[model samples]
Target: MSKDVWVIIEHQDGAPKKISLELLGRARELAETLGGTVVAFVPGAGVSNVAESLGSRGADIVYAADHALLQPYTADAYAQAVSQALQAEQPTLVLVGSTAQGRDYAPRVAARLGAGIVTDCASLEVADGHLVATRPMYTRKTIGTVVFSSGGIRIAVVLPAVYSVPPAEAGRRAEIRAFQVALDSKGVRTQVREVRAIQRETVPLTEADVIVSGGRGLKGPENFALLDALAKALGAAVGSSRPPVDSGWVSHDYEIGQTGKTVSPQVYLACGISGAPQHLAGMSGAKYIVAINKDSNAPIFQLADLGIVGDLFEIVPKLTEAIRQAKGRA
Candidate 1:
């Protein structure tokens, strides 16, 4: 009777993505509340180990779809595999991380399965036997809670870093089932020629506990070195506004805004950024926000826990030095 919650896991280079575990934690909580089992769906080659890891986090069962054609992420292939799994398992709810891959895969799977899908949900809970999904709309100016009907099944794509990763339990056991699907490459438009990974330190913005972001206030790309140094001192990931990304000063992956990654880090430091509504929509979930800008009237200061009205050029270097000195004491 569709009594279990299923999660789709994403992996690269044989390693599971961090957001998958975070979604597992959320799914576990929901399953406990609804008195249902938490199941994980892993797709790709040699992913049985990753399926086991999902059990350690909280999955009650692991469904592994191992195929050579599934080695690389293709919308058609993944949708087909997940659709088959859903049809067989009859899960009441399906959860996926709203990462780049999930964004591409979840909708396709939902469309194929004829299931209702809610994307970029910040929070989820079961209310009166219905899954309630909370998501931002109108550029984060408004929040809406959606309740799906008792239709086929409910599927939700959640933003990364909105929830914490649950602790893994040693020696946890899950029933592992291997599944197979037929792939027809007919009419496939896109082909993967090569993949190049970006080298960076600290965690991904969505998974990072702390993020140090800069905006147009830094003046130009050359000044980003100061921001990077400060972020290093704080052991935080670096994020940028749309201007920096559009100017080619920073990679598009590092951009944080409405069209970019939505981060809920514990601490978000905005330097020289004006805090437009679009940008704030992505970072409003941060536990604490610190703004450093010369414009005291900047909208960013309205949401900041700590506001510094000064030239970022002068303030950033001093702050970096102070953090270095403080670290020395530790």
Candidate 2:
């Protein structure tokens, strides 16, 4: 197999996602250690524009796979096309972002190639001539070190925000090549005719720098307004533990736990959460955790960098006002 690190680029609104650029940055480091070049693969309809600028970000070579069937991002088409390309080139390592879209199709590509894959990797490095990944397992109770066996391609689905995006090097250029996947009409199983996006007041959980999350201590759906006020003051996305979601206090989009979205925000302010293992598994990667609960012994306090033992109903509003006033002064 060639010692080339390949990154599958994911884009939105005609630009590459932040996670994709992050993957490129990590790939550059890995390629150096492996004595290989960084290769970026952009698969979409009319994606030459998207593939062109990746060179400065770190890719030494770019393969633009443009086909009509690749549009609208059906899992079937992506899996088939990517698997076919990887099969042909046989790169040493394939890296994909562990977003919803990547989670949907990456496993299929791995299955097609019969390659070993590690998902939701926290860190990756070359150890003893093989790629090693650190992954959280069993609801994040333990972290396991994984090493790929010899003689096959390796794939890793990395979590977002784990690495810093490198500054683009001016005047650095890559060999841009057009790659075509022989797609059969019958092979494309799903068709997306329309897409309706939801209007969100805050950024998506995965992309948010700060998150204000609530749990069972919220008491009722109306109480989330308190969280909303706090979130607005802090310029943070609003999230919930499983209880609030199950109680119909909020939609699943606002949920953050093992069964919900995994986030690694710069700050995670968990209010009223008891810090269940499942809930901890999702947001434990946050840079700083602050918890507020009436119980001093609440499990969340153990993981919190700052713990407030008080009633959230009284504390949250005061905190929100303080933040708003602080912002006004700034």
Candidate 3:
């Protein structure tokens, strides 16, 4: 078995992306157990300046493929680049973030090398000398563990925010090298015409350490304003169930459920949420779940770590005041 663990780095500027850093933390842990080294492979247009931080976050070596055509993420181009790196490096484990770009290209890279891959893996550890990944199944009704049966080299696409970002060690450094990718006719299948960047004003639920989500039981859209004070007190992001968004009370971006954004925060405050399977599928990965609703028989009580049976109007304001006073925020 190859003793080198590799992570594909994705970034635009000199800094590494959030998911890249998170995977590096996991790769570092895995490499230590195997007595191996961690390598970061960056394939894009002009990413040489991004190598140093990657090393500080636990990469032993930084291999970059800086080419002109690699700017806007194209699956064929990136797959070709990653496939070349795999052929040359022969790392035991390859971890990629399950971002939109990663989801598009990881499968292609696996196909190029005829390797098996698992997507959205939640956790991984060395078990019986093999890496075992744990994730949810049955819409999170159960946990499923996965292992690569073909079992030579493993490729895994990790969910974002599943792992915390690795702390950077300022003094650490890495030996840097560049990999070359040659794109032929087949590799240049699609041309990206434009890339639009959407700048939403709200905190992204995926990145929030704490989230406060309200459902239809909040009564109407206007009543959701009651949550704003509590969310502010806790320094948490505001989210909603589908009803508010469908009712046009809140924007669709704030919706959290199967049809909306999946979130895994440290603290999930589900106020007035009924805990539908679709809603649970999104936030079930949260470390702590607190549900506040008037109905003690609510389905949310089944999943909440702490259940508060009271009217949110009364409970939320008092809770907000308590948090503010406790924090000495006045």
> What does candidate 1's lDDT look like per residue over 102-197, in tens digits?
899889888877889999898998888788889988878889999887577788999887788888898988899887766666634467778888
Local accuracy by lDDT, each model:
0.87, 0.92, 0.86
Full-model lDDT, candidate 3: 0.86
The root-mean-square deviation over C-alpha atoms between each candidate and the true structure, in angstroms, is 1.4, 1.7, 2.4
TM per candidate: 0.96, 0.94, 0.90
lDDT of candidate 3 over 163-238, digit per residue (tens) = 9986789889988987777766466799999987646544667778999999988888888788888888888999
Residue 105 CA displacement from its true place in model 3, Å: 2.0
Location of the lowest summed lDDT over 10 successive residues in candidate 3: 196-205
lDDT of 2: 0.92
Estimate candidate 1's alpha-carbon lDDT, on a 0 to 1 scale. Answer: 0.87
Q: For residue 143, what is the lDDT in candidate 3?
A: 83
The true-versus-predicted C-alpha distance at residue 199 of model 2, in Å, is 1.5
Cα lDDT for residue 171, model 1? 92
- Give residue 303's lDDT in candidate 1 (0 to 100): 92
Stretches of candidate 3 off by over 4 Å are 12-14, 184-190, 201-203
Badly placed stretches (over 4 Å) of model 2 are none
List, residue by residue over 1-330, the lDDT tens digit for candidate 2: 899999999997788888889999999999998889999999999897789889998999999999999898999999988998899999999999999899999999999999999999999999888789999999889999998876678999999888878998999998999988988869888888898886779988888899999999989999999989999998899999998888888988888878999999999999999999999989999999999999998999999999999999999999999999999999
